[model samples]
Target: MTSDPTVEPGPLARSSAVTVTLLAPVARFSLRARAGDLAALSGALGLDLPQKIGDRAAAGAVEALCLGPDEWHILAPEADAGRLAAAAAAVYDAAPHSLTDISDREVTVMVEGPAAAELLTIGCPRDIDRIAPGRGCRTVMDGVTVLLWRDGPERFRLDIWRSFAPHVIALLRTGCVELATCS
Candidate 1:
């Protein structure tokens, strides 16, 4: 299918390289830390613990969010994925936290445009607005526990497990396609 050239602003569509996939509009990352070690993990990253990271995440300074007591997910541009993975690993290497490169294990999809929010409603029951911008929540979306973040009014980022990545993507594609047809 042809992309809507006019959908995104000029700079947003610019490519840095031909091989680099700009999953633009949406991207995802998975970060695993030892259970109960998230606080220490953040310290290594120069960020505070718990919801403190979420505060900075909203401003777009850093897109880090706590997924569980021992788990956290850092969302950024697809281009930054490699750097982020290494940075996180080096920080947690000798520490109590165990870091894993889950970049290839999950499907990160970006849902943008005027219908982004509406499309998300198909899989998410939470009030997307309640989470606010830059902030995210760990909730079960369509029976899947997903970390949903509101990066912008028309932008959102979803990180699902590697095994379920394809299914999640299919579901999203179906939802968005259904919206397009309905509208």
Candidate 2:
């Protein structure tokens, strides 16, 4: 898998929006569980789940979050995503749960640096800072549902649907440039 400069760096992709600077190459994994098996499945997987998947990922080790009643989206380093998925499948496959590898189905953008929070505020309405570290939330940004993770004081992970990822990136990039030129 040669790197595609057009695709950005890391496991995420750079936003097409020139205003918002985005980190590249997000590794996305989707976990599917049987009805009523979310707790045991999560416990068996040993993930200290936060109140919300996206919010909890900000607590350091985590990279991104997604939510569903019997499903969750876990984003991490592309290289490690397969490992996590495989581990989960092995442990839960026989336990009446199903885990699918949807790493390629979405786009992940890591927004960081001094202006990350401010940049995100342009698209997200939630009080991002109040979200607390290590927690995630569901919100619409630039007309797309996103999984938001507060990676740090100025860092956040934004996961959007693959189809809408480019639009979000473009908008953010535009915001970044506009903000930069303003200040």
Candidate 3:
């Protein structure tokens, strides 16, 4: 490893009020289905696919976020990828749908602690405080599209494209310092 003083650790930031960290690897899927296929699809995948945009559903270790009436973003433990994919495909016998594996296309950025919402607002135009826990929506941060999930009043996660991660991290790093200093 190079002894570059400018290079910092992987965590986006960690301070008194908040902790921004990159989540461990997880399997991700972009699922699309017709209105009638929701039930069958959910049964096959073991997670209820929400019907309303921004709604989230969870079953054990799996979670699904409804980004649109016909589209969902699915997340699960990394080792479950192949098994989950096979299950989703089995639905093809009765319900015609699409499930594209997207595990490598993005990474999860988790912002936790009391200042989570406020930190997000640094680059997000929407009022972060309004996004209720258990729900998520497709939004932009610093012009990059992100799947914003509010896990609680003090915890949130942003699913960001891998290519834009560095840019996002830098902005957040600065935000964390500023927030701490301002507090």
Candidate maximizing TM-score: 3
Better of 1 and 3 by TM-score: 3
Ranking 1 against 2 by lDDT, winner: 2
Task: Assess every candidate by TM-score.
Answer: 0.61, 0.71, 0.93
User: 10-123 in candidate 3: lDDT tens per residue?
Assistant: 566888988998777789999989989999999999977889998999999999999888999999998999999999888898989999999888878889998888899999
List the lowest-lDDT window of 10 residues for candidate 1: 13-22
lDDT of 2 by residue, 7-93 (tens): 354433233332233455556666666555655655655564434444343323434354755556666666766666666666664
Q: Which ten residues in a row have the lowest lDDT in candidate 2?
A: 11-20
Q: Residue pairs in steric clash, candidate 3?
A: none
Top-scoring candidate (lDDT): 3
In order, how many clashes per candidate?
Answer: 3, 25, 0
Q: How does candidate 1 score on lDDT?
A: 0.56
Q: List the candidate 1 regions with Cα displacement exceeding 4 Å.
A: 1-43, 46-62, 75-95
RMSD of each: 7.8, 4.7, 3.0
CA deviation > 4 Å runs, candidate 3: 1-10
* Candidate achieving higher TM-score, 1 or 2: 2
Q: Model 1, 1-183: lDDT tens per residue?
A: 124332221222111110101243334455566645665666555555455434434224345676655556665566765665566676664556555545554544456667777767888898876767767777666788776767777677665655564456556656655765666
lDDT score for candidate 3 against the true structure: 0.87
Q: Which residue pairs does candidate 1 place in steric collision?
A: 26-110, 58-134, 105-162
